[model samples]
Every structure is written in C-alpha cells, then in structure tokens.
Target chain A: MLPTQLSALLADPAPGVPEALDLVSSFDQGLVDGLARVSPSAFGGLVDAFAGSPLRDRVAEAADKIAAGSISDEHLFVLAGARSALFGAVHDALLGQADAALGRTRASWPGGSGDAATAANLLAGSRSWLRELAITGWRGVDHDLVTAAGQTIEAALAEPRLRRLATLLDGLAAELRACSPIATMDRLPVRRWGDLWSRAMLLAQDGGRLTPSEPVTGRLLVLGADVHEHATAVQIQVHGILETPGTAPRLVRTSVAAPKVDTIVGPAVWRLFAAHPVLLGALAERLTLDVTDLPLLDSGDLLWSDARAKAGPPADPFATARVLLAGAAAPAVPPLERHPARISEPVFVEGYTAVDGAFTLGDRTIAVDTTRLPSCGPLTPQLVAASHACIGLLRWDDGGWSLQPIAVLTMVKRQPVGVHTTDWALGPTDPKVVKAAAAAGDAVAVLRERAGRLLRK
Target chain B: MDVERRSVAPIIPPVKPRKLAKVPFVELADGRLQGVVSSGSDVERVYVSSIGAGSHGLSCSTNNNRPCGGLRGSYPCKHLQALLDEAVLQYGADRVARYLRIDVEEGRSLTAGLRAHHEPSPAATVFSSFLRHLAYLELPDTTAPVPELHWFPSVGAAH
Candidate 1:
C-alpha cells in the first residue's frame, strides 16, 4: 500500500518531470516490491550503512500496516520508482568507486534475505535505467546513477562471494564491450558441420578493361578442414553485381553453362574414363588419383545424371548401376567401351592434378597436360582456374560453376559447335584466332582460324 | 588387387600419381624436404613425399589457435594426418592430394611426424597475413583456420 504522494507521482505520464519521478512509475513493480521488502534481519554482515540512515524512518513507517488490501498500480509504481532511485544511486557509486560501492551493496538489511535485498537494490537502478533508455533513448540521462550504485558496496571484505555474485550480474549486463555505440553484439560464427565460408570480393588488377579472353575472372574461396576429420565442404555465392533501381535491363533467355567444363561425352566413355581417371588425368594432363572431386556441367538432356532418389551421387555407381536401384550407372555406361569419353580442355588447368587418361587424336596425344601450370601470381593454377571459373560463372546466361558430361551423340545432334571427331570437342574459342574472331561476333572466321591454330598448336 | 594385372581394381593403396598441388616452395627452391612452420596457418602448404610406397600426401590442421599440435615437419599434426589417411580410401591418394593439397600417406613416417610449431619464418608470416586478410573480411574465401601448415607456391616464389 503506497502512500498518495508516491501514487500520484506514478499516475502522471507526461510534462516536465524530475529525475526521481522515473523511480515510482507503472513501469517497475518488481523494483518497488524489492526495495520495500529490504530488511537488515535477512543479511547478517554490515549493520552500519543504514543503522542511522534517513531511509530507516521511511521503511519503519511503511511497515506499520496495509491501509488498503489491493495494491494500486500507482502504489506499485511508487515503490518501484523509489527502488529504482536507490539502485540508480548505487549504480553510480559502483561506477565511481567499484570496491567501495560493492561493500555497501552487500551490507545487511533489516528485512528479508540479504541476496534478495541486494537484488532489489540493484533492480531499482536497473529498472530505472531501462525505463530511461526506453523512454528517452538515454538522452539527458544522469551518469550519476551509475556512480551512486558503486557507493553502496561497502561490505565486500569478509563477504567475498557476494562480490563475485555482484560482479557476475554486472558482467552479464555489459559483457559485450562497445567499440561503437552502434555495435551491440560480438558474433561468433558457428556451424553444425564444419564447412568453409565462400566470399566474393571484386577488385581490378589491370584496368577497367575486361580481359577479352577471360570476361569472368571468378575466384575460388576454398575453405576445407585439414584432414579426413575434415571433409572438404564447398560453397559458392555471387557478390559485387548489384541490381540498380529503375531502368530494368532487358531479359535474355539462354541455356545455363554446364559446370566449368560441361563437355558432352557418352556415358560409356565417361565410365571408361572414371575407371581410368589416371588415363583422363593424363589426357587432361592433370596426373591425379581417385579422390579428387570434379564439378560437371551437363547437357540439358540428362536432366538427372544419377537416377537416384537423392540428388547426390550413389555409394557405388558401377555396382549399383546393374542393381536396378537408384544412382546405379545407367546401361549407357559399361565396364569397357570402344569409344573413349571426353571432357572440356580446361580440366587440364592447374589444380586438376588428376584426369581419366590421355586420348590419341591423330599423331598427337590430345592430353591438355596441366603438369606445368603455375600455382601463384597471374597465371598459376589458382589464377587460371579462377579466371576460367570467373568467366564461366558470370558470362551472360550460360555462366556458373558446374561440370557435367553429355553423350557425344547428343552434342553432334545439337551441333552447338563443330565436332569433327568423337575424340575432341571445341567451344566458341579454342585456337587463339578463332577465339579472337568469335569475341568480335565473327563466328565463321574465328572457327576457321581456330581450326588452323588447333592443327598448329 | 588387379588380379588380371591391368590394375583396374582401385587397390586399397592405389598407385599414387605425383601431387603437383603440393606447392614445392621449400623443396623446389632450396631443394629441401624440411621447412619451418612459424604460424599454425602454413601447415597445408607442406608436401610429404614418399608417403605410401614412395607416393606422397600432405596434412594440415583446421584448428588454427590450438597450434596444430602433433606435426612432425609438415603443418598438419597427427590428428589431421589420420583424417587424410582415409582420403586415400575415397579419392585415391594422388588425385585427392591434388584437389585438397593435403595428403594422406599409406604408411606413417616417424621422421615426417615432427612438430614444427616453434620455429618462425618470414614466408610463414606472409602466409599467415594472407589468411588473416581472408578472415578479416569475414569472407569465406579459403579453408577455415588451416592448421600448422603454410602454403607457398613453388613457382610464385621463384618468379
């Protein structure tokens, strides 16, 4: 049962208000109850701070009796507000003098539990601060409250555990250090499974002029764990290119580019090469082993390469293919095939340490050996791969990181480009001149010149 | 077991091809199999030769702050070494090392397992800074907190 003055103070919501007016409001009932409930009997240690204090008379008077049964919102507000005021002062004390204020906050109270009393006192200032920040957004807020809170902790010596408790609360309240007022939390990234994060940062090296050959210079943000304990996880996302407001760009429809080298090769050929990855590695000139993973950009016809229920690969494509189960290799692939499969030449780029095998194209073994690809700078494996992928991932509609194989039969039928032999295929740019001519939108000249370069190179 | 002798079985310890991804910086430049790992970050750059039957593999730590504890001379410690060991079971030794740049040797070498945690090198600092740049941007560009191993391109240094 709060008296009328406190009740009246709580009822008013607006107009020129005093600093203490915030203490006794509808906003903090717990604060008021906590302050009013403080008792020295509950806490044993320090009996000095309030023994002759001015607050003693007020507590004594409030203890006489409950004049009314129902506790009005206004009454609760006053009690809360008063508690808030005390806590605010205590808060200021702690900020001004940490150790001294700690002692006073622990001093024994005449009422209830010492812990409860401490919590109540702290809650007073805490609630006030919360309201002040909430109501005025901390503008014109008193720094004195924080200082006053520090003064109440005078009894921390023998009751050391109490100090720890007080510190714990304070720490939680302000655990995150503020570098900037705008910065509120320190985020630590956590993932259920270990995986590398991929980020794309676009920076120019030469000039604003996009390379005529490598229009897209995509970089690989490769994050992998050290060992088997760490299965290399990969993620790719687009960065830099932002949509501009107004002036909608004209839409163009085109087929998606198969992953990096989505060359179309027959299934039988693909299997033959898969078994002989070293052979393809040799042909691709990668010189790799089995564990190396490759992305495939497939011809659209083979919508689902792996006939499995799930999108991922099957446990064993070879054995499962004949099992009539999903993800088994299709009948198109066999143990051995007269026709060897083929992948794009870019597979010979740097990090591609493995390939199926070298295929004989005329007197030359058309194995694009990446045996000498550098690993750093502008033309290293990383650099070349980045450049190729960048172009693949960003070139018009047929851009992205993908690796798929299509049947040679399908490629011949579609005739995206000329394929004289089943052994090799060519893109818009193969021989240098053809690539150059193609860039100029002159496909016929480029193709003819590229065919000659192919013979020469 | 290529029972037929053509060797199509993908034998348990398949024949390993040369791992070009193992940046041959120290080995190629100074022609040294031995190198120092100043920061735990450069562990992955190490290339261990003669792993299984003369085939090589690499190992690196994912735990950057933990100091990638059990490395012999290579960057990744024993824990990561074991993880790579199984990679041979999946991707075959040579090809896997090429993609990951980390290898799993068939047989463990007592000498290759030495810890290079203490010794510092300028190349290592450069490698560490490289990693820091990636991390500071909070961009997931490279593998996370690569362990005791450091990667330096063999040719990049030469150039």
Candidate 2:
C-alpha cells in the first residue's frame, strides 16, 4: 500500500492527491520489502534480474533524474516499481511467516536458521525442496501482506510510475515464480539475497583451483602459460546393490558440463569448481593475458637453441657454483642430489612434479597440494612419465634458475619465445596445476616459435 | 568486429641521417620515453607506440605522471577519449567515427585501437620524424552507438 494509505490504516484515513501518493509509496516500500524477504523463492528473481542488468544504471539514472527534475518524470513509474521491489524484498525476508493458516498435513520441514551458512546443506535443501515441490518454475510467495501492498499500487492504475513499477515487477516476479519458496529463503527468516551465497551450490567448469606449474622453453613461450583446458570426469561411488548386499557396487559416475570461452578467462575458475553470482558479475574485470610479455627480463637464448631437445638435458640442478664456473669443461652434470629441479620439454605432453622448490621445465614455481602429490621424494615414476612432456627444463646456472620452452607440437614454429614467471599458486589440483601449466606452455611454444621465425625472416 | 589484421607491410622508406633531422625528446604516457619532430614537408604527425601494449598512447597532460595500467595500454581510456573528442570538435565526429570508429564499451579507444602500434618508445624523439610509421585501424563500437556504427555484431566478433 502507499505510505499515505498505510498511514491512514494506522490512524484516521484521509483522501487527497498527496494522500494517494503517500499510499502508493507505502505500498511500494512494503512490496519491495516483501520481495526481499521472500527471496530465493518469492524475491530472488528480482535480485538476479538486477545483478548485472545492462539497463541498471540507466534505470537508476532515470529515476534520480525524475526525482531531481534533471529529466522529465516520465520515469516516475519505473522508480516507484524499483522502490516497491526493495521494500517487498525486506518484508519477505524478515517478517513473512510460512505458516499456512488453513489446516494442512505435510512433511517438508527442513527448518531452522544457523544451518543456512553451510552451502552444502543449503544446496541439499534447495534440491530437496525442488523435487518435493515439483517446481518447474519460480514458486509464488504467498505473502498476504505483500499481495495486499501490491494491490494498493495496482489500484492506482492512473499513476504511470506506479504502473511502470508494476510492469517491471511482473517480469521480475515471473522469473522468481520458478523457484521453490522455502528453498528461496537464504539466511533470512523468509528470504534475503545478501545471504544467498551461503546456501547455494556452485557447479564445476564454473571454476577450478590453481593447477601445478611446469617449466617451459622460450620457444614454448610463444603461447604463454595462460592457456588451459577445462574438463569434467564422472566420479563413481557404488556400494550395496539394490537387490542384495553381496552385489558389488556398480560405478555411478556424475559428469558435469563444460564452460564456454568467456568463462575460460577467470582466476575464480582457476580456484574453484564453480563461479558465484558476485564473481560472475566481476568476470568483466578479469584479464586474459597475451603471451607477449614473457620476453621482458629474460636471461637469454636457452629457449631458441635449435638443438635443445636433441641435445643433452640442462646442467644438473645439483651442480655447484664452482662446477658451473668451470663451464664446458664440466661434462653435462648428471641429474644430482635433490634432483635440484624437475624439467619438461617444450612440447612435452605429460604433467610433472617438482621437489623442494626446484621447479623445472619452463616454470620457476609450481603450486601443488601435498595431498594430491603422487609421492614424496623427487617425482614418482607415474608422475615423471605423466609429466614428461615439459614446457621447458630448469637448468641450474650460477645458482640462478632459467627456463627453456618445449615447442608445442601444435604450432609449426621452430622455436618458442618465453616462459611465464609468476610466483602465485592459483590452486592445488593435478590437472588444475600441472596440466594447466602444460597447456599454457604448449601454446606458448607454438606462438613464440611463430613470432621468432617472423622476426628472423 | 572487422579489426583490420593487416600485416605490417615493409613499405617504410629508409631515412637518411643527413636528411633526417631528429626531434627533441619529450615525456610520454609510458615513462620509458618518446619525442616528436617534423619530417615530411607537408604534415606534422607521429606514430605513438610502446614496448608494452599498456603504454601505447600520446601522453596527455593528465596521464603524463600516471602509468597506464592496461594490458596493452588501457583501451578507450579517458586520455584517448579526450583526444578523440578534441579531434571530433576539430575534424568532426562523423569523420572520426567514420575512419576510426571508437568503441568504448567493447574496449576500443581511438588512440589505443585506431592509432598505429609500434615498439615501446625506448627514448623520446620528435614523433614527426617517424610519422609514416603510424597507421590508423578501426576499433569496435561503444554501447550507446551500437546500431549507428553498422549493426550486426553477431556477424562477427571474437568476444
């Protein structure tokens, strides 16, 4: 109901133009509050609809302009609609009770508040509610109060602002109508989007953690280590057979879908299996680096040496400064104690692991989860073979580290340009880390070679 | 969407030290360096390029002291817009938009997207000395003037 109407109901009612406006405002506020209160179910649609809305700034500006006379009040209805939405949201979130006055018998009680903070629980509850409610679309929020408030604004059919607000709200409501009511309630008693994330279950391909790092030759630097591929594997967990306890568990695997290229350009995806609303909104801010910058601060030609792969491996990481100082006289130092580092060929296909900080292949650093590690000392036979396709190898030189990129077989370039040299561990998954770095390095070598040949000719 | 990816044709005429009078060094967007000098008799122009993509633009008074924090020079930056607006006021918006459409929302700026790209100005010199080094390329369009700048984005756009 409009504020004036609310005021009237609270005391002696008045009938006038100002009163009518006040009544509209009061109703608008209540509706917005109600919408907010019943979010996830009744109000979430409005919030989602507003999140990255292209017309958001425009709508807001139009409203402000009309209110301030900077522009015509043609936008008054739009403003009123938005205002009412806000008020409805708050009401649905805090005050709206889910008690059905009429006698009823149902067992959909997944009650309480504190548990809202646990996303797993929230997600489970949401899923259950959807299944039980058979919710094919956004569910209706049965807030008598909000319904009444909406009516008050609707009653003022002549008010253009109020009418506009109703039109937009209708659209928002349509989207909201698809969710389950109880599941809609985020952390609030009814529903409030601010607490929405605590109860949502994110999806994979939506994101990933920092994958391990790999060394790459300068030749592999052509594509830079920013390249990556996202995939999902179905995990099967089968236990007792439905027919008998003796039956072996048949593997039941679940496969998630893949994301698109736009989704590929985010660190959030690099850190988690899924993306959140806020993070998705921030996607536009993320940067997709081109492999071109690796050449700066480089220490020189190990990457472009034509005979690298065919030639012997780099000087052993264990080689002492005294030995390195000896130069060529010292036959290629044998892979030494601590293996000082692990290395990768520019076009190597296998993922690799490093011991103690001796990251080889073109990488100086690699982020790995100790738990996900294949084994302790050096690299396990499995890891070595798996990580054999190195982007580059790390060769010890005067106690300093340098990378050589393995040419990516994909690119026809003879030599790669550079290597990624960052120290941040984006995450700790195997494919996430090693494979990601490998893919990036793979592309790098291809590009670097192309650029090198381009410059050469 | 039709970002002209034409190869850098090796058509530049060699400059003779005897005839090539160098320009005085001056500050540029990137602190590294740049300078401008007149070369050809008729036009006084310069090819503003940078080593890092992030620093490729003329150093306007405002950004002179600021390092351009861009992947390859902040495209559609205020400095670029200012320059374009000035150009629009001088040369006319229609012409500027016609020859080099500046698409702001799509991340295109006249200076960054339209101006010629070259290596970082390691040292400042009269930009006019290498005027021919620059080439104008088209950029995508901004949000507001979508349809006006040739609709059909779906026809092609890498993004």
Candidate 3:
C-alpha cells in the first residue's frame, strides 16, 4: 500500500539517504505495513528518524496492528528489535516533552493504553524541534527531548505512588533515564564482573586493598574497564590481584568509562545494587544486607569511608544488617540455651537493677558481683533482658549470689560471607567478636604493610 | 662437661614473627582491656576500662560523634555505657574487680531494650565503597526503573 518512493526507501540497506522532508512529511500506516512485510532490515533507520516525533505513535499503532494480525514471527522479531533501538527512545523523548509542557499530568496512558489521538497530536505538533535531533547526535538539538525525559522522571520520583505513571509511559521514562549506548556488560557471568567490580572498588579507596588470607579457588586477576562506564567510552584502567596456590599473585589490568550524566552514578548504582545485591555481599566481612534503600551517593561519594568526619559517611553495616533483618520474617533462631541445674526451678527474678559494682535482683535485693574485665563493667539492655529471661551461671559467696552473663547473644539473620547462604544465628559469638576485634588492628596493619610493600616495588 | 662442645648454633633473630593475623590484646596494670578489633576493613586499637578515673567518669578513647552523657552528670552516655556493658560480657563477673555502681543500678533501666551502639570501624568503610562500586559497574540491562524503596537517598545532614 505504501507509495513506490517510500517503499524504495524502506528497502535501502544503508539508510538516511532519502529525501528527508518528502519521505517523513508524508509518512503513514501503509508505509509501516509495507516495511514490516517487505524490508525489515530498514527498521532501525525508521526508528532513528521518528523516535522522538509524532510518527512514533503511528509506528506503535501500526506495530500493534501487525502484531495482532497473522504477521510472520520473523517480521514480528524485526519489529520487536527495532522498538527498543528506535521507537522506545523517540517515544520517551516525546512524552518527556509533552508531560513537561502540560505540567503535572495524570497517569492516564498506562503504557499500552494511551489516548492515541491526543498523544499523536502532541507529538506531531512537536516535530519542528524533534526533526533536527532525529538524525544528528548533536548536543543542543535534543535538549528539550532529554530535559523533558529527565523532568518527568524527577517528578515521578518525588512521589513514589506515581510509579503507576511508569507503566503508563510504556516505561519510556525509565528507559530514557537509565538508557546507555554501551554494549551489554551483563552478558558476562557475575563471577567475572564481580571480581572486576570488587577490585575497582578496593582500588578506588585511599590505599584500598583486599587479600583474603584463605586461598580461594578460581583466583582471578582481572584487568577491565571501570564498572560504571562502557569499555569503549573511556579508558581508566584498574587491576585485580589474584592469589593462586603456587603462583605469585597475578596482576590483572582493567579500565572503566564514565557515565553519560556523571550525576547518574548514584541512581544507576542503586538500581544495580537492587538487582544483584550478591555483588555487594561478596565483599562483606561477616554479613551482607540489602542496601538498595540507602541514599544515593554523590559523585565520588562511594569512595569515602563510613567513618569520614565531614560528610557522606559510609553506609552503616550494622544498621543495614538490622534493617534488613527487620524487613523480613524473623527466621527461626536456635532456642535459648538454659542452665541444666536451674531448668526446673528457673528463678524468675523481678526488678533487677545495676548497683555499685553489682546487680540487685528481685525483692530480696541480692547483689550479683561484677566482672574484673574492665570491658565487662557496663550493663546493657540486652544483658538486662537476657538476665530476666534466662537463668545464668551463678556463683554464691559470703556477700550473696552473683550472675555473670555468658555472652551478648542476639539472633542475627544475614547472608554469610563467601558461602552465599541466608540464615539466622546467635551472633557476637567468638567468631564475630574476633573478626570485629581484628579489623581495627591486625587486619589493618597487615593490609597496610602489604600495600606499602607493593608501593615500594 | 667439655664433650666436643656442640658448636653453639647461631641465633637468627627469630623470624620477625609474622605479624599475627589476630592482634593481641594487652592488659594494662590498672586492669583496662586494650586490643585491636579487626572486622575486615576496620582496624583500630580500642581501650576498655571499668572505672571512670577521668573527669567524665569514663576512660574510653574510642571516637564518638555524640558527647558523653555520663560526662554531663547524667546517666552514662551510650558510648561509655556500652564499653562497660561489653567489659562485663568479655570478662566474667568473677575477674572484674571494679565497676561504677550508678551504671549497675541506674544504667540498666535507662539503656534497657536498646541495641548496643558500635563505633563505625575502618573495615566498615572499606566494605561500603567496595560494595557501592561493585554494584555500579556490573549490573546488566538496567533500563527498567527500580522500585522507590530500593533507591538509596543521598547522604545529607540527617545522619
């Protein structure tokens, strides 16, 4: 049904050479149908031309009709492929502009169910500016397109309930916001990229370094581009040090490209964290929790430590761990261990309070002597609750009875380090305590020394 | 005893003992507990004491963002108070010879049901940056917008 000139243009392998105004100005549904039935190869060029224009709606409409018909799977495949490459971007840019020009619009379209006529008219009317940006990647031409997309996204974000708008816009806003032109990096397995991401993270720190003392298998030394940028975009190199059983630690070199909008690092990273949180888990010492709800990091904020004095302190592992546990159903924990002797006559001591170097329990006011460990002097709420709930090991002397709480036990649910298992266990035991204690001194010194040696070389 | 004197072996200065993977805690003469707490990226020397000899009624050297309430003549602040509580748990009631009576009596009720507050360690800092970057570079095909709860807020003065 398309005219001969339009049909000829659709079949051209290397496109964009058509008499631009004549071909686009007279676009119609028959032309799209002809292209779908005949020259599917030219689909990509079609998208590039009309992506942010009024013709996008018509393309969507035609594609929908074709999809509903007895169209061959091959034609359908070509159409599907071109939607992402062309229609999706143009649709986003157009809607972005429309929403901004109209101001605080309602979530009416709901993705596949927009008022076709209105959307078509709005987009068609905006063609003057879109036509210029259609073919060229020049900066200023697409300003309204990009800005509108950004603004709509920001508005939707301001009120979380507006996510219904996401489905309405055919998810164009999101696509536009997170859109990147790089080749897919996710095609690579997590294990490969995980090492690169971890190493780059460590390297980003001031003297950032990690060498798990335990000899890990598949000790990979990766040299890749920065995780945030595409391999082809920029050329910042990073190295990964893999410790093999017999071989010297291998140094793998890597590089990373910068993001399109440097400001996008936070949202992009946050989304990634949401999708594959195990990536973060791989780096935790004792546990790793979901950190997607954390605030966005500023440009270069991720490089700073949680203990930074001025601003943008690092994310609190303990708080993150606690919040993660609180969000889910509390896992079944090991039953509280009870003293064998006191099981039958478990003393329900009431109104216990801290006294001078001792504790007074029950109406009798019996003083439980305190410990010699200076670290053990202060009484905490958990210690109090445990004392009330469970009968502890007690020693009776000339002064009276004394109880020493065995341990500060709380059931902590988290994914264990290295094993990738999520389970709940009574924590602050010897292992966690030891890990925390060692982190401040021995672990720091060891890593620092190793780094110093590496620097010396 | 002059049996062909076994050649006195030369003493190689004991291989500078490979720095222990675990830092050793030193006990001061006054019964304070000093040790390096290492949880991966965080490494620092922490000192714990039972008696508050300083003007503040506490002798801990750990850094805290909030002022010590115990220093203000109120109940021991969460920082010093946590130290005392940890000391009791670290060393059983038998060995610790001294403790503040006010905390034993009043501190229990005041801090009851509250989770013990811990100072952020250097290791925690390392993990934050590591995890952040790891998530940034590698998650594939993120064109779809994530739910709002998953997005983290930028750090502001709220903390």
Candidate 4:
C-alpha cells in the first residue's frame, strides 16, 4: 500500500527536503521512472499491482509459470524467491526513505554543504540504485546477495551522481555481468552433497534431543578454529559457545578429521591440534568443561563422541560474550532456514569500539573483514585496534558490512585476554604460549613435527 | 556516544598482491580490466581475462567459456600479458594507467601504455569472482550474521 512514488518518498517533509539536490534529482528520476515501470511489458502492471496481495498467489503462481513455458527448478526457486520478496518490499521501503534523507542531511546541512555533499552523493546513488533493483530481481538467489549486490554496484559507480542515472548505471553494469559462477550456476537451488547429508541426517534425527536429559553441565567457550583443506580431508572446524548455568548460549561445532597430506600446506588449527594428542586432550578438556553427554545436533552441532568431562568454573569469555550479546534474538531461523551452504551470519560483537579498521558500535560502523579470515591468524589492524570482544562472521566483503573477527575479547597485561587464550587458538602450553610460539618461528612446531611424521606413517 | 578513535583509510586502498601467483586475480572491476589468470600450460588452468575501459575491450576465456587460444589478432595475450602484469602489481602504474584509459608517461610502464583490442569478454564472471574468492576459505568457523551480510555499501557513500 505504498508506491505513490514510494509514498511520497516515505512522507514527512521528505517530498524532497531543503531542495537536497532537488531531492537527489527526484531520486534519479524516480529510479529511472521505476525502471520504466518494471518493464517486461510492464509485467502485467506488476501483476495487477499484486491484487489482493500476499504476493498475489505467489505473484499469480509466478505469472502462470512464466506464461506456461513449463517452469520448475523448483519453480525457478519459487520464482526467484517471490521476485526477491517483491523487490525486497521496495527495497525496504527505500531504506526508510534513504535513512531519513541521510539523517536529515546530517542534522541540518549548513557548513561546507556542497549541496549537502551533493545531496549525500545523490542519496547514495539512490541507494545503489534501489539495491541493484532489489538484487537484480533476485535471480542468482543470494550468494550473499550476489556478493553484496556486486559490492553495491562497485560502490555505486563512485558516485558524484555519475551523470545522474545513465540508464540506471547501464542496468547496473548488466547486473554485474550476470554475476558469474558461470552465470548463476544454473540458477542455484540444487544443493546436493546427498542433500547436505540428508539435511544433516534429518537435523540429527529430529531436533537432536536434550530437554532434561540429565548430564548437561557447561562452560565450554572456545569459539574459533576453522581450517578446511578438503580434496580428501583436513577439515578442523571446532567453534564453540555452550555456557549453561541458567541456559541460553548454544552454537557449537566440532569436526577435526585429517588425512589429506599432499605435502602439508596451510596446516595450523594449532598445527592440527598439535598432531592429535587425543584431539589435544579433548580440546584441552573441552576448554575447561564441566560437561557430560554432549551429542546435541539440532544444527548447533556438537557430538564429541560419548562425551563426559569435568573441570569447570572459570568462565570469562568476555562474560559469556556479555551474556550472549544481551540475549541475542532477532534470528528466528531463516538463513535459508539455517544452513543450505550458510553464507556467513554468526555474530556476538559486545562492547565494540576498535575504530579505523572499524567496529565503533552505538553509532554503528562495523567493517573489519580481514577477508573473512583466510585460514585464520591475522586479525591485526593491531589486533582489531586492541579489542574488547569481537567473535566474528558478519560477512559481505570489500564494499562494506565487515566483522570477520572470529575471537577477540582483549585486556592482556591487565589480564582477561581470550582470542581463544592467545597465541591464537591455544596449545603451545602457555608461558604466553611458549613466547608466542617462539616468536612465530616454531611454525606450529614445524607443523607439529610434520604432522607427527605423517601420522606415524 | 563519543566514539572517535580515528584511523579511516579505505576509499580505495585494497590492491596489494604484487605477484599473486601469476594473476590469481586482478581488479579495477566492472568498468573493467578484470582478472583471474593462472594457466601457463595448466597447473589446473584458469583464465578469465578482461579489458574494456574506453573500448580497449578484450577478453580471454576458460572458466568454461573456452576461447583463449592465446586470444589472437588485436594482440595482448600471454594471459593478457599476465593480466597486465598483475594489474601493474596490484593497481599502481598510475592506477593501472588511469583504469585502462592508459596514458602513462613519467617513468612509463603500464605495459608501456599499450592499446589492446580483441573484444570477447565473459570468462564466467571473472572466473566466478575467482571462485567466490575461493569459497571464503571453505567457511564454517561460525558466530553467524549473514542476512545477506546486511547488504552494505552506502554508509552515505562512505567518505
């Protein structure tokens, strides 16, 4: 019930503010006259403006299966996820009228207002051309929104309102040349590694049980590992969270594996948990565990085989990530219902701050993405400018929304460190992880003595 | 909300490779110059070239589009001169000679300001963006926030 030029660009004196570059050239001529009234011969007037809409019977059953050319690839991924949820509800109602007209032109324009920085760079090139027209009408169904709408159309063609809307930036440079993976790898949605191991064995036989199963103590923490390798196996994974005194923190992971040696390249998950000393003493006694019977896999994976451990009481993983980012929420599932190749979404943040490489917090910011930690290690921009709780995987690279941290929590000399107990992911038996693994020379003790002579031949 | 701690830097600054194993990926991006080279007689091949700014339009193929028989004629191959020598060692020679509108002079060298031509172009979206940047090192470390990584770009056009 909006679209009267986006309800006069979301009302309240925003019908083109203090002539903000004539309201950013009438929002680049109303998004190139709303992409020539949603062409394809005005798509039956946008499916009769979605009649009696709840996306009008899935936009009239995806316009009668694209007028009967017999659709299917699961109705072309439900008609490109219902035309990207109807152009993401008009790109989230023009990002609430371009973040309230760039927060009222940065709180009442004035000083050095080159027309309020060219009307806030033409309202950020009309919000990267309405977010690349709602991610090119969503074909290429989310590979992290086609890599953040091709880095928001390469930072919206470095806008100085690049000649207003040159054919809507040449159809966002031909939808960033049909976002390659050989052009949307046959429009995704095939997903089969035996349907992700039969949806992880039907999410581990229906909701991997736990309710009052007795033996459920906690305090695990850890949160970092990730190694990978593959073509035959090297895996690693690890990750953590547990914290069960008065419940609510869960997300776990485990993995490990090994074998794939083709000349041991990039090893490090603390040199394969230092050549598996019984999986590094069951991950150093499940990082100070007070656990029993772990198994639980309703996707928060964790099964450390017939687990049962003791040593607890000493948890300060940044005060359990400030009681799990003050009781998290706002996730109610949906990352393609949790994980069909889950393209990044784990968070945690805590008292942000950091600065330049970015983090900030209250007034938002974020940025940090050290290329989503390629085989972890360097989180440095001087250790995220001396942290105070980070824990990573926010995603979308280069053109913004960063945070690939992994584990942080700071303090050091005044004690409380925890980048999984320093020397990045523990082990070398402390004395400050054997003086930071002998000043980074004992390359994980020569790759754990060549992976313990190739796992004892 | 005093938040300042300063440090900024990143309007562009993100090229840094210098060699990157014979053009493992170059950039300039979309307006073109592009990347993903590799193949000198296949160490498991790669190609995905590009050029295009100011109709210098060329391409080289292989991430399945095939082509690249040393992309003949209007010169420039040897994997597009090793992706213009690793995009002049990750964007330098006067910003890849002003993003391929090549002018070069002072201590000239962005391939001595050449003019390439062959106009082919698709190499599966710059080798599907170098295999989605090598599938972000096979993911799974976890903490989870990928709601399309909060569709970034437009912090009021950054600076």
True contacts kept of each: 0.04, 0.00, 0.01, 0.00
Mind giving the per-residue lDDT tens digits that candidate 1 earns over A97-173? Answer: 32121111221212221122233443344334333322222122232332333322222211222322222222212
Ranking by lDDT: 4, 3, 2, 1
TM-score of each candidate structure, all chains considered together = 0.16, 0.16, 0.17, 0.28
Chain B, candidate 1: TM-score: 0.25
Which number leads on lDDT? 4
Cα deviation of A138 in candidate 3 (Å)? Answer: 14
Candidate 4 clashing pairs, residues 3+ apart or interchain: A344-B146, A345-B144, A345-B145, A345-B146, A346-B143, A346-B144, A346-B145, A347-B143
lDDT of each: 0.21, 0.23, 0.26, 0.43
User: Tell me, what's the RMSD of every candidate?
Assistant: 30.9, 28.0, 32.0, 22.7
| Candidate 4 regions with alpha-carbon error over 4 angstroms | A1-218, A221-241, A252-457, B1-26, B29-144, B149-159
Sliding window of 10 residues with minimal summed lDDT for model 2 chain B:
B147-156
Per-model clash counts, in order, read 111, 116, 63, 8
- Give the lDDT of residue A260 in candidate 3: 21
Ranking by DockQ: 1, 4, 3, 2
lDDT of 3 by residue, B25-141 (tens): 211112222222222233442222223212123332322222222333334443345444443443333222221222234434423422233332222222222223223233223
Q: Residue A204: error of model 4 in Å?
A: 36
Query: In terms of docking quality, how is candidate 2 classified?
Result: incorrect
Candidate 4 docking class: incorrect
For residue A99, what is the lDDT in candidate 3? 28
Clashes of 4: 8
TM of chain B vs. native, candidate 3: 0.28
Q: Model 1 in CAPRI terms: which quality?
A: incorrect
